[model samples]
Every structure is written in structure tokens, then in C-alpha cells.
Target chain A: GAGVSQTPSNKVTEKGKYVELRCDPISGHTALYWYRQSLGQGPEFLIYFQGTGAADDSGLPNDRFFAVRPEGSVSTLKIQRTERGDSAVYLCASSSAGGYNEQFFGPGTRLTVL
Target chain B: AQSVTQPDIHITVSEGASLELRCNYSYGATPYLFWYVQSPGQGLQLLLKYFSGDTLVQGIKGFEAEFKRSQSSFNLRKPSVHWSDAAEYFCAAAAYNQGGKLIFGQGTELSVKP
Candidate 1:
């Protein structure tokens, strides 16, 4: 079975540009998550979606970051006015609905803001 | 706040040697722990998880982990490591209250020598 997958394995943008990263979760997964991994650091949670609504967005660093899963499967993470500080690997993960399920991750999209 | 810590920034071991990667976590309640591996250009892969029941848990690719609540640790071990095992290992705790988002450690880079 195909695991979670992200589009545009790498993205480069200038500062103050806007970028969107896409994620395709597994066929039946109802839970999707986004995270950011900076150099020499672990991944930090960004947001989570259950079905079509975001259940948690506390990890989102600032107002410039936003995410959505409209159809309940594919998710898009949007960043506005990209900054050099936003340069990092954006990771997407998905899991089935329920308790304590293992998260399947995608090959993250590495975003570089220059 | 829930957090995870992987004390070793890096470790090197010869192929066929025993391996141990230490992971410690801080959470208010009984935590759901996990081990994940990531190779260059790949997504995170689950190695094992500890939710309940027995303390010792086995995972794919000949990896295993032991949960020690007394020490608030979940250390990963492998009887003999293969050259292919060289990669980054992450220890994480599931923040169930916040929609099962993962709190990851800084990660430990493992280099296997011939």
C-alpha cells in the first residue's frame, strides 16, 4: 500500500514569498498532522486535522502559518511571507482514527527561504 | 509540558555489534512512547511503540525497545546492528490530549562502521 506522500520534494523561495506544501495521506486515514523540522533539531508539531476540521493548531508558530484538509484526505500547509527562519523540512503524517495508532509519515518537503 | 530527549547526539558502532540508543521523556501521565528511524531522502519509519502491557516491545528490522517508567525512559536496542541501520533515530511521545500529536526528541545519528 502506498504510504503518505508529499509533493515537490524540495522548494526554494525568496523571503516574503508565499508557498504551499501538499500532502496526500493514506486512502483511509482520517487524521492528518503537519510538523516542522529545523536543522539539528527534532520535528515540532504544527497542526492536526480530524476529518475536515482542524482539531489542534496550537503548534503553529505564528499567523503566517495555516493548514487545511478540505476533503478529509489531502492537506495543504500554507505559509505567507516566507522568512529565512521558516526554512526547514515540513513533514506530514497520517493515522487512522482511534486511540494510540501509529502515524505514517511522508517524505517531507524541504523548504528553503533565501 | 510533554517533551522527549535523546541524550546522544551521535553514536558509531561496528556492524554486528550490539547497539543501544537512549531516550528519555517527560510527561504528566503514563505516556505513549515510540521509536522512529529516518534515512536520508526518506520519511520517518516506526520502529516500535509502547502503550501498555509488557514493557519490552519489538519492532521491524530487528529493533526492540524497553520502557522503564521508573526512569521515564524508553531505550532502543538491537542485538546486532547491520550496516544498513545507519540513520537518524528519533524518540517521541504521543500527546494524546492534543489530538495525538507527537513530541519528538532532537534525534540521534547512528553511523555503522564495517
Candidate 2:
């Protein structure tokens, strides 16, 4: 089976610009999550979606960051007015609906805000 | 707040040598622990998970982890490591109450020597 897939494996943009990262979760997965990984650090949660609604978004750093999963399978993480600090690897993961289902992760999209 | 800590920033061991990577977590309640491995240019791969039942959990690629409630720790160990095991290892805790988002540690980089 195909694992989670992210488009635009690498993206470079100027500061104050906008960028969108896409994620395609495994087929039939009901939960999707986004995370950010900075250099020399582990991934930090960004947002999560259960079905078509975002169940928890407290991990989003600020209002500039938003994510949506309209069809319940593909998710897009949008960053408005990106800053240099936003440069990092954006990871996407998906899991089935359960108490402790293992998450399958994508290769991630590396965004560089210069 | 829930958090995970991997004390070792980096470790190097010869192929076929024993390996141990320590992980400690802080959470209010019984936590769901996991071990993930990330290779360069790849996504995070689940090595194992501990939700309940047996304290000792075995995983893919000859990896295993032991959960110690008395110490709030979940340490990964392998009796003999292969060169292919050289990569970054992350310890994470699932926030089940908060929509199953993961809280990851800083990660430990493992290097294999011939």
C-alpha cells in the first residue's frame, strides 16, 4: 500500500510570501496531522484533523498557520506571510480511527523562507 | 504539559554491538509511548509502540523497547545493531485526550562504525 505522500518535496520562498504544503494520507485513514521539524530538533505538532473537521489545532504556532482537509483524505497546510523562522521540514502523518493506531508519515516538504 | 526527552544527542557504536537509546517522558497520566526512526530523505517510521499490556515490546528490524513506569522512561535497545540502523531515533508520546497528537523528543542520532 502507498504510504502518506507530500507534494513539492522542497520549496523556497521569500519572507512575507505565502506557501502551501499538501499531504495525501493513506487510503481510509480518518486522522491526519501536521508537524514541523527544525534543524537539530525533533518534529513538533502543528495541527490535526479528524475526518473533515480539525479536531485539535492548539499546536499551531500562530494565526498565520492554517490547515484544511475538505475531502477527508488530502490536507493542505497554508502559511500566510511566511517568515524566515518558518524555514523547516513540514511533516504529515496519518492514522486510522482508534485509541493508539500507529501513525504513518510522509517524506515531508522542506520549506525555506529566505 | 506533555513532553518527551531523549538525553543522548548522538551515539556511535560498532556494527554487531549492543545499543541502547534512552527516553523519558513527562505526562499527567499513563502515556502512550512510541519509537520512530527517520533516515535521510525519508519519513519517520514506527519502530514500536506501547499503549498497555506487556512492558516489553518488540518491533520491526530487530528493535525492542522496555517501558519502566517507576522511572517514567521507555528505553529502546537492540542486542546487536546493524549498519543499516544508523539514523535518527525519536521518542514520542501520544496525547490521546488532545486528538492523538504526538509530542516528540529532540531525537538521538545513531552512527554505526565498521
Candidate 3:
């Protein structure tokens, strides 16, 4: 893809439901990132992937939030037992050609937990 | 833990007026700095970034930012902002060796008045 691509631009799920958000980073990008943005706030880091390994997951709020990039190309963010407080936009980004490169973002998935 | 702060929660500026948005970071090292803009219901677009070299770095959309090491600040500026520049702007910082996981500040909402 020319840029990072995300699927299911908008998602609505009831409490206790599970949801998965997908991201397809640009070809050859070595790094990927996930973030969540609440209303009237800045985006918060959730996770990061370098190659097939998760380099950092410290920013993830809790056990309910999980993400994986199996092949290092496509990644998925899963939320279990969704809560109304989980309602926010999930953003994905990728950087190519190594260190200090700028990240290109996807359109993002607007997840609304009811 | 690393973090960022954007002081002004909301700012209104007339079209063609000079614009400045403040950002401060708390990090052990001189971290990589960035500014991103997000329009209504859209993904974030990178405005500019600072790594090494010059303290002042140029970015897209006619924006520039200066990284002050002692102050731990990276303030974004534009000589004249357009009406189209009305959006939410985010300031972010990440460690160079931290695998690209970014810590972002609370955004500044810019409302450009014609």
C-alpha cells in the first residue's frame, strides 16, 4: 500500500463484546505503532512492533487491550469485554527505512463501545 | 516515564495570522520530536519532525519547529496560517532507540477564523 491502511473505519460494539481492529502498514516498513485518542485529548500510545516482535507494550492500559503483528506487515488490535470508557479512535502508523523516519498514519477506526 | 504537555487546550486565530503552539517533553535524552495535524474526522498528518542537526526543522504545510534542548521544548510555528489549517494539533516525543513508540501531549485545538 502507498500508506498505512486500516479496516472497519467505524465499529460499534456492546459491553462485554469483543472487537478487533486491523492495520496494514506500508510495504517494507520495519516499525509499526498503535494509539488511541479520546474526545478532546491527544493520542495515547498503546503498543509498538519491530519486525514480528512487540518491542513495547507498556503503554497498553490493561489486559483487555492486546495487539499483534504476526508477519510484521499486518497488525490487529483486540479489545475484550469492551467498556463504554473504551470508546475512542484507534490509529495505526508505520515508518520505513529505519531510524528517525516519519510515521505515516491510517484513517483510523472509530470504536464506539455501548 | 516519558511524557509531553501541550499547554493551550484551544486557540482561535484569524486566517493569515502567525501561529504558535507550545510543547514540552520530559525525557532523559534529547528525544525525537514531531508535530502532527488532524482535521475533523480525519487521520493525523505529519507536519514536521526534529532529530539531530539544526535546532530548527522545516515541515510540510509550511510549518516549522524549533527544538530547544535545555528547555525540553519543541514549539511548532507558521508565519501565516490558512483557514484550512484549523484542526487539532499534537506534539509528540519518542526515544531514538525506543523502537518508534511515541508519547504524545494533550492536543491543541486550532480554530481559524476568516
Q: Output the lDDT of residue A49, model 2.
A: 90
Q: Estimated TM-score per prediction? A: 0.98, 0.98, 0.95
As a whole number from 0 to 100, the lDDT of residue A84 in candidate 2 is 97
**What does candidate 1's lDDT look like per residue over B60-92, in tens digits?**
999999999999999999999999999999999
Better of 1 and 2 by DockQ: 2
Ranked candidates, highest DockQ first: 2, 1, 3
Global lDDT of each model?
0.93, 0.94, 0.91
Q: Per-residue alpha-carbon lDDT of model 1 for A1-114, expressed as tens digits?
A: 999999889999999999999999999999999999999898999998999999989999999999999999999999999999999999999999824788999999999999
Q: Give the TM-score comparing model 2 with the true structure, all chains together.
A: 0.98
Predicted model with the maximum lDDT: 2
Let me know the DockQ for model 1: 0.76
Per-candidate clash tally: 0, 0, 0
lDDT at B58 for candidate 3? 96
List, residue by residue over B1-114, the lDDT tens digit for candidate 2.
788999999999999999999999999997899999999988999999998999999999999999999999999999999999999999999856766789999999999999
lDDT: worst 10-residue window of model 2 chain B: B94-103
Q: Lowest lDDT 10-mer window, candidate 1 chain B?
A: B93-102
